[model samples]
Target: MTPTAPDRLVLVGGTIHDPATGRDGVIDDIWIEGGSIVARPTDPSSFRQIDCRGLVVMPGGVDLHSHVVGPKVGFGRRVAPHLARSPGKPAAVPTIHATGAAYAALGYTTVFDAAIATSAAALAHLELADLPILDKGIYLLAADDVAVLNALDRGDACETERLVSDAVRAGRGWAVKVANPGGAVFWRKGRGDHHDLDAAIPGHDLTPRRLLERLADAVQAIRLPHPLHVHTANLGLPGNWRTLLETMRSLDGRRAHLAHVQFHSYSGGDLDEGSFGSGVAPLVEFFNAHDSLTLDVGQILFGETVAMTGDSAAAEHLAHTTGVPWVSHDLHLSGGCGVLPIAYKEKSLIHAWQWAIGLEWFLCATDPWRVALTTDHPNGAHFTAYPHLMALLGDAAFRRAAFDRIHPAVRKRSPLKDLDREYSLQELCIVTRAAPARIAGLPQKGHLGPTADADLTLYRPDRDLARMFSVPAKVFKRGVLVAEDGHVRATPTGGTLAAS
Candidate 1:
C-alpha cells in the first residue's frame, strides 16, 4: 500500500532535540507539509495541529546495524521456534511483520540489515519490502564473490573497483560489507580457524588485511553515501583486539566502519579465563586518535539472543564452545552464514566480562558522533533491548547497581566500576538517532530541520530516561501518524533506500 502524507500537520510547543541541527531542547513548533518538514505556513489555519505542550520531540530513530531479514534470519527463526511463541520471551528472530511493528512502536524510522550476500539481494529485498513504516536498505556482501576477490589478488585495482561498483548498483546496496574477508576460503578448506587478517587465503595470495584496504578504497572511490562496512577478522575470540587494531592501521586513514566492535575488544589470549578482561582501553585510544573510522558497539545485554553473521568461522567457534544447536549454509561459492541461540548469564565470568567490555567502549569513546549504539540486534541482544541499554548509559547509578549484580571477579577486573560519566539528553540523541543516520549516510534523516523527512517522535518528558524513550507519545513517519504510546497505529508500506 502506498504511504500517503496527511494534508498538513503542526507539532506545537514541543522541546525539540535535533542535535544534528544544533537545536538542543528548544521549545518550538514544527510544520509538516507533503511528507517533509517545512517552514510554517502563511495561514496558521491551513494546518491541522497536534498539541505537544510539555513534550520532547526529535527525529525518528535510525538503527545502523541489525539482522532483521533474509536467509540467515529465517534460519534463526526456524532453529529457535520457541522464541517466537514462548509466553514470557521476546522472539529471538521475529517475523517480518513483527520486526516492522516492533521498530515502529519503538519510534525508529530507518534501519539497515548489516549483511546481505550479493547472491541473495533479491530475497532480502522481498523480505525488506514487507517491513512496513520505515525506510530500509541492506549492505551487500560484495567481497564474498570469488571474482571480486580474484580481482584484488591480481592487483587489478581498477577492475576491483568496477566489480564493487557493479555489485552495489546491481544489488541496490547502500554500502559494501566485507565480513571476515578471505575467511570463507579458509572455511571451505577446513582451516577457518587458521585465517587471520594477515593470513593468506587457501588458493589466493590476498590477505584479509589487503581485502579490507582495497575494498575500503573501492567504496570511497564509488563515492557512495556510506563507506565500506567491515566485520573484521577474529571476532569473539580472546585477544582479538590486536586484529582490530591491525585492521584499523591497514586502512591508513581511509574511511571504514567496524561492526560489532565490542566482540573484538577482549584482553585475553588463548581463551584463558584469567586473561579475559576489558581490552577496550587500548582499542578506544586507537579509535579516539583516528577520525576516519566509525563504529557501532554491538553491546551484549545479558539475556537469550541469536548470534547470526556472514562470518561463518566466528559462528563455528561459538557453536563449538557453547555446544548449542547451530546451523550453517554455504551458498555455492558466494558465501555462507551461521545461526545459534546464546544466553548470557550475569554470574558467568565471560558473559560478565563481555557486558563490561561493551559498556567500557561506550563510556570511554570520546566522541558520540563516531560511535553509534547497537546491540547488534538479536546478535548481542534484541533491538528491543535498546531502552534498557539507554537507561544503563544515561543513569550512572543504574549501571553500578547492575554491575554489582554481575560476577564478583568481573567487578574487580573490569574498568566499568571506575567510570562515572553519564550521557546527557543531547549526547544520547547523537548516539541513537543523529549519529546512526549520519553514519549510514541518510542526510534527510536523524534531524528535524526544514526540508528533512517528517519522521519525528514526541515524548512526554520523564526523569526515567528509558521510559521517556520506550513509550513515545507520538511517532510520525513521512508525516503520517504511524504509532502512538508504544503501539503501531498505521501499517503503511515503506520504501527501500538504496545507493546507485
Candidate 2:
C-alpha cells in the first residue's frame, strides 16, 4: 500500500508549538507540499488553504521507547484476552491494526518498538506492515547473540563492532539495545542472582560493565542515529539504583539511552519493605550533571496492565513474587523475553512508591529535552493512559489530589509531596515530540519546521489537560488527514524508519 502524493496546502491561523524551530505558541500559517512542510509559494493561490483558527497545533507525537510488537507482545495479548474484549476500546496490548489506529487517534504519528531480537526482526517487520498510520522502527537486541557475546568476551573490539553493525543492518533496526546484559545467559544456566555489574557471566570472561562498554563503543562506531539503548541489570530489584548509577558510570562519557529508569531507581536491600523508598535524588543529581545520558520514566499509573520485557530474570522474579501465570521464551541463544499480567494498586506499598518515584524523576530533572515520556507501553500502563499522565505532569493540583490517595507511608517518605513543578505545554511538546525525534534520529518527524515531514495534530483548547490531549480535533500524517475528532479518517501505509 504505497502512500499517494500529498496535496499542497496551507494551515492558516493556528497557534503553533514547534519546539525544534522555537515557534512557541505563535499564531502562524504552515505550508505543506509533497508530504513535507515547505516554504510558502510565490503563487499562493495554487495551494489549498485550511482554516485553523482557535486551535492549538504541534508536530505529531513520537514514542522513543515502547514494546508494541513482537512475540512477547503477542503473548501479552494471549495472557490477557479480557483486556481486549471491551467494546469500543483498545486492549492494553492491542492488535496490530488497533495499535496504529489508537496511536493515530491520540495524535501520535511515530513510534519505535524498544526491544526486538535480531532473530525476530523479520517477523516483527512483517507484523509492522499491518500496523497503519504511524512510522515505526525497532531497536535490535544485538548483544544477546552468542557470537557477539563471544567477541566481547575475547576483547575483540573490531569483531564486536562488525557484528553489531551487521546485526543492525541485517535486521533493518533503528538502533542497538541491550537488556540486562548477560541476563539471558545466566537465566539459561539457572543463575539468576548475578546482580553485580562486575560479576563475570558463567563461562564468559566479560563482565556486564565490559559488555555494556564494548557495545556502547560499537554503537558509536557504527554512527547510528540513536545511542545504545540500555535496560540495565537488577531491574525491579531492591536497591537497584546502585546498579543504574554504576551502569551510567560504566559508560565512561560514552553516549547511551537508559530505558525505564523508574524501575531502576529504588532504595533498600533484600526485599525489606520498611527500608524501600525513593532513590531518584542521587540518580537525578548524576543525570543532571551528565549530558551524555538521556532516559525515559516508565511511569506506572495505578491500574491493570501487562508487564513484558527482554529481561527474563526480572520477569521470572516478578511472576514468582506475584504467583501469577507468566510466559517466558528463550530465543534459542540470542535472547529471551517474558510477559505477564500485572496490577498496580494504590494501597500497595511498592506500587505507591513506584508511582511516586516516577514523578520524582520527572520533577527532579532539569531538562525536558533529555527526558522522554513513556509507560514502557503496556508494562507501566497502556499508551492510551498517556493523556492522563500528561495531566499529572501539567496540573499540580491534579497531581497532588491523586498523590494524597496513595499509601500513607509513601506519602510520608516520598519527595513528590513537596514538589510543585508543573510542565508547561511548550515543555510537553519538547518531551513528547521534539526531544524524542531528536533522540531517535528522526529529524523530519517531530517538528513542523520547513522541510520537515508534515505530521501535525490540532486540538481544541480546554482547561482540562487530559481531555484536551486525549483526542485531537484533527491529525495529519505526511500532510494527509488521517484522523479527525478521535476517529481514523484514512488508513495510509506508514513507512518503516531504519538506519543505513
Candidate 3:
C-alpha cells in the first residue's frame, strides 16, 4: 500500500528530543509536509495540527541486529514453540503481527534483520513486509558461498566483489553479514569444532582469517552504506578470545562491525579449557582507534529469553547445554541458523557472570558513540530489557536495585553495583538515538531536524523504567499518531529500505 500524506501538520506543546539535530529537548512545535519534517511555518494556515502537549518526540527507533524472518526465523518459531505462545511476552520473538505491533508500541520506527541468506531473501522480505510500523531490511549472508569464497581464496578480489554485489542486488539487502565465514559450509561437510580463525574449514581452502580479510576488503570496495556485518568465529566458547582478536586484525585497515560481542567474551578459568575473556582488551583498544568500527552490546538480559543466531554450531551448543527443544536448519543452497530457549537465573553462576560481562563492556568501553543498546534480540536476553538498561544508565538507584537482585558473584567485582555514574539525558540520547542512527547508516533517523521523518515518541517523564518505555504518552510514525496513552490509535505500514 502506498502512503498518502495528510495536509497540515503541527505538534504542539511537546518536549521534543531529537538528538540527531542537536535539539537537547526544548518544548517546541514540529511541522511536517510531504512526509518530511520542516521548520515551523510562519503562516499557521494550510496544515493539519497534532496536539503533542506534554509529550516527548524524537525520531523512530532503529534496530541494528535481529533475526526477524527467513528459514532461521521459521526454525526459531518451531524450536521455541512455547516462546511464541507464552502469555505476556513481547511481539519481537513471536508471530509476525506480534513482532510488528510490539516494536511499534515501544516506539521503534526502523529495524534491520542483521542476517539473511541471499538464497532466502525473498522469504525474509515477505516477513518484513508483514511487520508493521518500522522500516526494515536484512543483511545478506555472503561468506558461506563457495564460489565467492573460492574466488577470494585465489586472490581474485574483483570476482569476489562481483558476487557480493550480485548477492545484495538479488537479495535486495541493506548490507552483507559474513557469519562464521567458511565455518558454516565446513560444518555441513562434517568438520567439528573449528573454533579458531587459523583452523582449516573442512571443504574450503580459505581459513577463517583469509575469509574475513577478503570479505572485509570486498565490503570496503563495494562502498555500501553499512560495513560487512560480521558474526565472529569462536562464539560461545572458552579461550575464543584469540580467534576474536585475529578476526579483528584481519580487517585492520578495512571497515566492519561485530555482532554480539558479549557472547564472544568469556574467561578461561570456569567454563571451558583456557578460553576466557582473552580478546576484549586488544579488541577494545583496536575499536577505540578505528573510527570505522561499531558494535551492539548484545547485553544478556537473563530471563526466559530465546537464543537465536545464524551460527548453527553455537546455537546447537546452547541447546545441548540447556536440554531444551532446539530448532536448526541449513539454507541448503546457502547458510544455516539455530534457536533455543534460554533463561538467565539469579542462582546460576554462569548466567550471573554473563550478565556481569555485558555491564562491564558498557562501563569499560571508552566511547559511548562506538556502542549501541541491543539485547541481541532474544539471544542474551529480551529486547524489553532496554528500558531497564536505560534506567541502569540513567538512575543510579535503579541500577543498584537491579544489581542487588542478581547473584552474589555478580555483585563482587562487577562494576555495575559500586558505580554511580548516571547517564544524563544527553548520554541517553546518544546511546539510544544518535549513535544507533549513525551506526545503521540512516542519516534521517535518531534525531529530530528539518527534513527528517517526523517519527516521534512522547513519554510521561518519570523515574520508572518500564513505564517510560512501554507506555509512552504518545507515539508517532511519519508524523501520524500511531499510539495514544498506551492504546494503539492507528496502524501504519512502515517501509523496509533495501539497496537492490
Candidate 4:
C-alpha cells in the first residue's frame, strides 16, 4: 500500500470548551484540515501537529455587531479633532489593519462592522479587504433610503424585494440594519427630533413602525441569514423600554435583532433617568417570551470611549448634552451619522444609574443563548472591556467589589448588588462565543464541532477570569496560529463572509 498523509492538523492534549457540543475541559485532540474540523487522527507522524496540552481551547469569538470599520467611523474620526490626540483614539481609529490586529489579539476571529450605508458600501469594503486575521462582514444601514421607503409606502413588496437584493448585492453586505428608521429622514427634514414611531419622516409618509416592519419583511423575504438588525427608536431615553417592547411586538413572525439593547432599555422616560431600573421587568419578560429576537448587551463600562452611530439625531443629542466634541454627516437625507466622546463615571448619578441598568439586563434576561455580550465598541465602552465584563459575570465577588465603589445613591437603589448569580464557564461560552455567531446567522463560526470552521483560541487557566480571556495563550484563525503571548504573529489569512 502507498503511504498517504494524515490530511489533518492535530491540536493535541488540549482541553476544549465547545459549548455547541457541551464538551468542557475534556483533554482531547482536535483535527483540522482544509479550513474545517475532522475526526482526530491516530497516526501522529502523518499529521502536522501543535502541542496545546493544559490549555483551554475554544472556538474563536464572533462579534454580532460593531462599527469598527464603516462610514460613520470615518465621520467620527473627521469630526473629533481633539479626540485624535487621545492615547487610544487614533487618526482613523488606528487604521483598518490595526482594527483587525487589535481584535484578533483579543481573540475575536470574526467581526461585523454593524452599519454601512449602501451608498458608502464601496468605501467600507476597501478597508475591510485590508483587514487581516479576522473574517470580516458588514450590515447595510438602510433606514429611510428613498427608493425602498417609497416602495414600502406603495405596498410594492415585489419592488421592495428586488431593491433589497440589489442593495445587498451592490453593497456586498452581510445583513440589514435600520438606525432610528424613519427618524433619519426626519432629521434631514430639520425636525431633528422624532420620538415616536408614528412620527412622520420629512419626504416619506411612513412612520418608524411601518419602516421597521417593511425592511424586516424585505430582509426575511430573500431568506437572508440574519434578520433586520435594529438600533431602535428613542434609544437612551427614560420610559424607552415601552418603545423597546413595542419594537419587539412589531416584529411578529420575523427574526429581528436589537443591537446594544442596554442602551435602549431605560426605566424612566427622562433627560436624567430619575426612575432608573423601573423599565427592566417588562422588557426582560418580553425577551423571555420572544425567541425570534436577538440582542447584544452593549454593557457600559465606566471609562472614556468614542461613541459613533448611524443615528445622527441620537449622537447629536449625546454630544450637545455632554458638550463633547461631536461630528455629524448628512448622507443625502437617507440617513446621517454622528460621533462623540463619552465617559461613564462611577460618581455621576446618571452614569451610575446607567451602569446599574446594564447589569440588570444581563441578569434579568432568562437565557444566555438569547443575548450576546458586547460593549458596542467605542460606544458604550471599548471592546477591551469584554474581559472585565466577563470577570464580573464569572466572579460574584468581583461584581460586588465593583458595585461597592459606585455612587452611594445608585448603590442603595441598584438591584445588581442584591442579585447574585455567578455564571459558569459553559454559560460564558454561550453568551460570548456560541450565541453571538448563531444570532449573527453564522452557524459555523462559533462552535467547535464536527465539520465546524477551524478558527479557535487557547487560554491558560487562571482564577482571574479577566486576565485569562484578555490574553489567550494561542489564537487561531482558519486553522492557523495568528496570536500568542499577547502579540500578533505572522500575518495569517482569513475570510470576509458575505451574502451575494
Q: What is the TM-score of each candidate against the true structure?
A: 0.98, 0.98, 0.93, 0.94
Please list the C-alpha lDDT of all candidates, in the order they appear: 0.88, 0.92, 0.75, 0.80
The parts of candidate 2 lying over 4 Å away from their true place are: 1-4, 87-89, 270-274, 331-333
Clash count in backbone of candidate 2: 0
**Positional deviation of 5 in candidate 1, in angstroms?**
3.4
Return whichever of 2 and 4 wins on lDDT. 2
Question: Top model by lDDT, which number?
Answer: 2
Could you tell which candidate, 1 or 4, scores higher by lDDT?
A: 1
lDDT of 2 by residue, 1-500 (tens): 34457999999999999998889989999999999999878888989999999999999999999998888899999998887776765788998998999999999999999989899999899999999989999999999898999999998999998998899999999999999999988888898569789889989989999999999998999899999999999999889999999998998599999999999999988754658888899899999999999999999999888999999899999999999999987745377588999999999999999999999999999999999999999999999999999999999999999999999999998999999999999998988999999888887978988889999999998879999999899999999999999988898999998899
Question: Candidate 2, TM-score vs. the true structure?
Answer: 0.98
lDDT of 2: 0.92
For all candidates, what are the clash counts? 0, 0, 12, 4
Worst 10 residues of 4 by lDDT: 1-10
Q: Cα lDDT of model 1 overall?
A: 0.88
* Candidate 3 lDDT tens digits, 416-494: 5655777766667677777887877887777778877777777777767657876777777887777777666676788
Q: Can you tell me which runs of candidate 1 are displaced by over 4 Å?
A: 1-4, 192-195, 270-273, 331-333
Worst 10 residues of 1 by lDDT: 192-201
lDDT of 4 by residue, 54-168 (tens): 8988899888877777667776666655555676543434467777777788888999988777787888888888888789899987655678888887778899999988888
